[model samples]
Target: MPRLNAVLETALYVADMPRARAFFEEALGLSPFTADHRFTAYTVGPSVLLLFLEGETTETVILPGQMGTIPPHDGSGRVHMAFAIDAADLAGWEQTLDAHGTSIEGRTHWPKGGESLYFRDPDGHLLELATPGVWPNY
Candidate 1:
């Protein structure tokens, strides 16, 4: 059976696109590879981080036969996502977060010998910087 190799994209909804863009640009130091009024896509490692405006993901049928209706949706509440970092770079990440005046909500020392730094984005999305061993076979 065919299996998935990796996750190529992840999305987070934002009420204000400019604010979200600024946070991802200035705070996270991520430059958008592709962007428009509706959404921005940032390349993170081999994956893409998509910041989309809330309730804007409605269906746009480009072709009648090939494309089907895309339902509109909006995200609510806080969302969570984690970024894996080099074990040696954990301290650097902490320093970066500090430099940006981003509060570290919590830190975790996993039982399996991993470390994680937790914080929130401008949209109250829980973001994490974790060391390699945070997950098995990661």
Candidate 2:
């Protein structure tokens, strides 16, 4: 018997689609993978990050249905998305984000190794970029 390896994709609701796209592209360096009237997608290494415009339309509230092999979401509060990068790339990433005027909330360092920086999107959702070897064994 054969089994399928699980993969993950993330979707986020943005109030301003254009701004969100610019931030993800310029600040995070994620290349545009696809786009449409309702949504835009960026290629994040092996995964894809999707952003959908959500607001009080004249009609009804739009809730995203499961669209990927693994849909990432949190039912309550503002959801968070985390990007993992090689430890060596951490400094460069930080500089790039700074140049793009990304506000840094703070960073956490692990005693064993690695660290992560927290920030927010234009919509006030939490986002993080973490270096590899960060989380110690559970």
Candidate 3:
């Protein structure tokens, strides 16, 4: 059986590349490590946040014998993802989001003892800043 370790990257679809880039870079403080006409990738701790143009992502195709490409995926509707943060940093994160003019959609205290701040990105993808206890294992 193959075992999975950690999530090294996560992809989010956006309608506007420039707007998404600005939200992740200027607003969220994530530095873009690479970008092209259709996508931008930002390093988030050990993982990468990949933002791709909606239609472009759906049209991606990989040719095995030739040049490989990311498998085509749909980029419609609101998608959700969470980033883990230190428990003590929750307050600061809220302040940061406020300063960025991003409204908090909700806040939840998980039954497992974790806490989360829910918000949306420029493209309306639901994003969360959560604590380690959000899952069974951090």
Candidate 4:
């Protein structure tokens, strides 16, 4: 039997569709490979990042306020997603974010060996731009 092996897409919940679209399209240098009012999809390298708005059409959870406050919605709780980039590109990536006026949550350096910068999308879902060394054993 052939194995089911493709990682085609990953979807994220967002409070505002347009704002999410703008952040990915403008800030992250990703264009909407597909889009509509309910969902917008962007090309993130070999995979696609999709934004699904919260509402009747979709059952996405909008954290009430801030990190660690939202009650669990789908049984499994507390999740975060990250985008990995080349370690050498960190400074240039920071420049892109700064130029786009994206809000920076903070940056972290792993004593072992790695770096990451955290930020949120329009809907406040935590996102990180990380280096592979952050999880060297994985």
Choose the strongest candidate by lDDT. 3
Off by over 4 Å in 4: 1-8, 59-79
Per-residue lDDT tens digits for candidate 3, residues 1-138, read: 999988998989899999999888877889988889988999998899998888886665765887878667766789999999999999998999999999999999998889999999988899999997888996
Candidate 2 C-alpha lDDT tens digits along 1-138: 898553467878877778888888877777777887657888777778878777422244345685434233323247898888888888887898788888789899877677888988778889988886566531
Q: Looking at model 3, report the run of 10 residues with the lowest lDDT sum.
A: 57-66
TM-score-superior candidate, 1 or 3 = 3
Superpose all Cα atoms of candidate 1 onto the true structure and report the RMSD in Å to 1 decimal: 2.3
Candidate ranking under TM-score, highest first, comes to 3, 1, 2, 4
User: Tens digit of lDDT per residue, candidate 4, span 101-126?
Assistant: 87778899987578899987767678
lDDT of each: 0.88, 0.75, 0.89, 0.74
Q: Pick the TM-score winner.
A: 3
Each prediction's RMSD over C-alphas, in Å, is 2.3, 5.5, 2.1, 9.2
How many clashes (backbone atoms < 3 Å, residues ≥3 apart in a chain or on different chains) does model 1 have?
0
Clashing pairs in 3: none
Q: Which pairs of residues collide in model 2? A: none
Q: Is candidate 2 or candidate 3 better by TM-score?
A: 3
Candidate 3: where are CA atoms >4 Å away? 60-67
Candidate 1 lDDT over 1-138, as tens digits, reads 999999998889998999999888987889999988878999999999999898777656254786766556567678999988889988888888899889999999987889999999988999999897788976
